[model samples]
Target: FASVVTAAGFSPNAHDPALFVHLSARGRTLLLLYVDDMIITGDDSEYIAFVKARLNEQFLMSDLGPLCYFLGIVVSSTSDGFSISQEKYIQDILARAALSDERTPMELNVNLRASDGELLSDPTRYRHLVGSLVYLAVTRPDISYPVHILSQFVSAPTSVHYSHLHVLRYLRGTISHRLFFPRSSSLQLQAYSDATWASDPSDRCSLSAYCAFLGGSLISWKTKKQTAVSRSSAEAELRAMALLTAEVTWLRWLLEDFGVSVTTPTTLLFDSTGAIDIARDPMKHELTKHIGVDASYVRAAMQDHVIALQYVPSELQLADFFTKARTRAHHRFHLSKLSVVDPP
Candidate 1:
């Protein structure tokens, strides 16, 4: 069978293969491979071990336990599914900010923003708050937008920036919030990315926002400043789509590594139709030829079957929560949509 399989052009793989068979006393099972990992499940562990032994005879391998950590996320199993977080990371940031004493979970006062009326003579306090909030955003997506906003003025933060520090302090009062990942859902990937063009008063560059989902739960996200200036809102959005596309490509490849097959045409949602059109239309005309190479590269990747792009309305775009400043109500709304909920 090995020779026959090899003759059929399916050679033994040390990493992973497109397909393999598991022969059992009762029946035979099939195994599929992505890039380097394989997902195998059966009713019988003994039979699974037999299959593993046969595969090991042909290649080198290591047996690890169930999936726990990946891409900096820490996962712990619950009766329902899994609890994921960077709680230790959050703790460290709190201590650094001199707020460890405040970690006892408590309801945050939205009124803390009123403290802006009081001026801090030392600007270092503002910088310290921004730094701590930035670190906290790793597990607390609810605070990412607020942190990004405060971080922008860290260089010469005024009483206004200091006022915003109350937002971070308020958030610090709620660090127990976390994102939960239950195992009951199907394995599907969806992504959304958006941008606010020339949002900064100093630099004209746009801000990029992206969110990725594994099934119904968000698994990854980002909100960052664009590296270059975008000539228009469309261009800013295109740049964001490009960034999201790159992330989708890497994620798909990683999923493939785990032997999980993802159908082609991975859907990526963008809020700007112009950006979507830019990604779909390969023609490099005057309006887009000047677009930064980074964005162009993302478009090219989308065209090459790396991922697919779709347009979403700005109002429905969750990525917007990451890229721009919002009022308290909208901030809570978007953060809740991302599934960053209060902890018990």
Candidate 2:
């Protein structure tokens, strides 16, 4: 199959074997292969049709027209931008599960979340809820942090049902809210990385979170707990920056394959000045020798001009939405910055 695509003039992307890029005087095209399924996209309509015909000659193929539905996401384009949602999947689970507004009581929810407490009677139910929320995180970045915290207790079991219920209610109310990508959004890549020191009382592991943006629209974000404990907030911040820098490098490579070459240095925003100093100052490494690898990786990225580090104040740090729970005002502020449209 790879040979056949290669024969059709598409060069396999080094960053991802599943992706292929075709460049010519006519235009550019990108093909992503996933087992039996493939998505072909490009700016040249004629070349797109030709590629379809060319691929069809070697193997039977069906062109699915424009991408309206794929991998559970429902896409709709408008004059303003594109809106994508897992509306069908959300509705299906809501109908089958015990999360319906009519059935679930409002008072069951608690204001503050607790990581450890009395063991849950039904651990399987907690696990299932965690799994569902994990799947939902594919389109719902707003729930990523909470879901990440809840998942840690799934194996040992702890307070969970009410937390899951709260998330379900949010999904129910914002069923129509969808991810929006504006046509006029910038093509340049920008990213945010942040970490909270000693956030987890149970293990003392720090929480690291980062989000990538394609112009104004968000393309990727993650919430994770560091495997090794950091001695200070600066160490945690550097580790988080290291993770995000690697992600940005991969994304840049992926975009280049898609024919959207990012010529300018990618912006990596963080709230930690100590991290910035550690990555920029060679002498600072003597003080941060324990985190040598992560510090060095970031420093090399800066030296090579792959990324430029900027210090955003903690209050304005958008990645804060992923590392810790926030007030309603803060949540909306970060949500809007990510270009998500909430349902009224």
Candidate 3:
């Protein structure tokens, strides 16, 4: 495949082997390959068509036309732009679980502690379900955190743990929910960084979460527990900011490879005033000394103008949804902001 793509005048992307880029004076085209399936896109429609013809000549490949479905995700084109969903995938999951008649809940509740009930007689089924849920979370960010929590007990799942699979039921009601990416959105880069201080009861580690937006549409997001324990909230928040800075830096490079130049420094919003101050100030306080190394990375990014860190009020902090559970109203607000909407 690499030889075929190279022969077709496309160079494979360094970051992703499956991606190929072709640049010419007229325009640029990107080809993404997954096994034998391929998605051809670029600024020049003619160039994209040219690549498609070349691939068809090289291999016995059929042109599926525009990308409406790939893998398990369904893409719907709209006047505004494009929307991606996994409705069919969700229904298939429900059918396999024998939960076709279940009702979807509006909110998710997760208990991270190890279950005290009897262990499942067959843990394989539980593991399989959890694995499937993890994949489904690709288009369903709302379930990311919950699925993360459930995944921890896959090896020794209990009856109590399996019961919490009600999250699947919740998916049944909102299966048509889709993520919208508007065509009019700019390429400006903006991101939100947040942390739930000492969220892990077992090790006292914080949970870090961040989401990056391109022209107000979500393109990247992550929710994971921090590696080291922090003594203070400011330190934890700084760690989260540092992680986000690294992500944004990589994303900026990726955009450049895609021929999208982001001239302005990426904006990183955080809810912690102390963390923001630490990132901006050259001198560090005694309380933050433990995180001096992590702080240095963030400071260097700021100094280089790679990222512009700003303080945001907790109420408007969008990454809050990824770090911790929120009230029903707050969850709905963040979901709306993330452009996760039900089809009309």
Winner by lDDT: 3
Say which prediction, candidate 2 or candidate 3, comes out ahead on TM-score.
Answer: 3
What's the distance in Å from true for residue 112, model 2? 10
By lDDT: ranked, best first: 3, 2, 1
lDDT at position 8, candidate 1: 32
Off by over 4 Å in 1: 1-76, 86-129, 152-160, 292-295
- Report how far residue 93 has shifted in candidate 3, in Å: 0.7
Tens digits of per-residue lDDT, candidate 1, 1-344, equal 45533433333544434555444465444455555455455445666676567667766766665656544456677776666666665565556565423221222322223234445678787787678667666777766766766676676666765644555455456656778766785688889998988876566778898999888788789888888898889898887887888788878876664456887767888879887777666674355777746556776776687777777888889888776556657767776678776544
Per-residue lDDT tens digits for candidate 2, residues 206-272, read: 9899999999888999999999999999999999999999999999988877778778889999999
- All candidates: TM-score: 0.67, 0.89, 0.93
Which residue runs of candidate 2 sit more than 4 Å off their true CA positions? 57-60, 98-124, 158-165
| Best-matching candidate per TM-score | 3
The collision pairs in model 2 are: none
lDDT per residue (tens digit) for residues 191-273 in model 3: 99999898876678998999989986899888888999988898899999999999999999889999888778899999999
Q: Residue 46 in candidate 3 has what lDDT? A: 76
Can you rank all candidates by TM-score, best first?
Answer: 3, 2, 1
